[model samples]
Target: MLVIRGLGSQYGRISVLRSVNLVIGRHQLIALVGANGAGKTTLLRTISGVQKASSGQIEFDGKDITQLRADKRVKIGICHAPEGRHVFGPLSVEDNLHLGAYSRADKAEIAADLERNYAMFPVLKQKARLPAGTLSGGQQQMLAIARALMGRPRLLLLDEPSMGLAPLLVEEIFNAVTELRKRKITILLVEQNANAALAIADQAYVMETGEIVLSGSGKELLGNERVREAYLGI
Candidate 1:
């Protein structure tokens, strides 16, 4: 469903992504795991078109989107729930969710999807009228994911969905991600929690210093000796 080839991006004069190549088949969950400075988030940003590519090409369903505007990308079914759980602080939780569907004109389907998200994250329904900033960190994370789902994304780009949450909440978030997989929501998850991410992914890639170092099925990478020593700490 998506293809990236020799992709490169930079911040000012410094390079962040170097010749990164990846592919995601429709309805498959793909995970990209690496250390803090490995440029995973930058890669997601570039693919989502929030950051411009310095070189290479990105194609979605065979059309080149490397030069498309970010909103245009949304119209083409690329929705990103970026890292940091960025929710509008003053907006009601429901409003934040509604904003996700801003690019669509289908009110009936949008309403249906809203209910679906509420069913997925019950707390968001409970706090429908509350300010997003008042929610707990885990609650805010759930809000972010649910908001993204409101866009009815074909390929969801989730960045650090479990960052800073408690262990139980982390488990909860991962379980929700698994639910997305079951729903056939194509995901390219950029996660620091290598174990959980790789375990749930159908296919996974190891990124190092802005480039893909290894690619394999999730189970294969999980048991890989080098992966265990470096990322898994086992």
Candidate 2:
């Protein structure tokens, strides 16, 4: 559903992504794994239109979206859950979720999506009136995912969804991501936890120092000698 060709980006004068080429099929779960500063986040931000690409093309559903603004990208069904779970601290959980649907004009559809999010994340429903900051890290992560779902995204960009949580909570978050896959939500997951991410991904790419060095079926990547030695710690 998305294609990126010869993608390059730089922050000021420092290049972060170099000639990155990637293709994601509809309803596919693709994981991008690498060490810190590998430019995974930069790639996602560029695709989501938050960061401009220095060169190359971004195509979504056969149309070029390289020049589209972030909000315009959202209207075209691309939603990003950034590295930090940046939920509004002071806003109630429901309000925060509601903000995600701001691009839509149909109240009934928005309400239906709200109900669907509540069903997927019952905890968010229970804490609907509570401030988002009051939730635990895991809960906050769930809220972040649920908030993004509120936008009814066709392709979801997840950046480090399990970053700071405990092991059990991390498992919970991964389980939720697995459920998203079952629901046929196309995902471009950028994660540091290579093992868990690869386990759940249909396809995986390994990046290092701003370039894609490896790409394969997730199971193949999990067993790769170089991948095991470098990222999996096997």
The segments of candidate 2 whose C-alpha lies over 4 angstroms from its true place after superposition are none
Worst 10 residues of 2 by lDDT: 113-122
Would you estimate the TM-scores of all the predictions?
0.99, 0.98
Please, what is the whole-model Cα lDDT of each candidate in the order they appear?
0.94, 0.93
Tens-place lDDT digits, model 1, residues 78-128: 999989999999999999999999998999999999999889889999999
- The local distance difference test score of model 1 is 0.94
Where in model 1 is the C-alpha error above 4 Å?
Answer: none
Best by TM-score: 1
Give lDDT tens digits, candidate 2, residues 54-97: 99999999999999999999989999998889999899999999
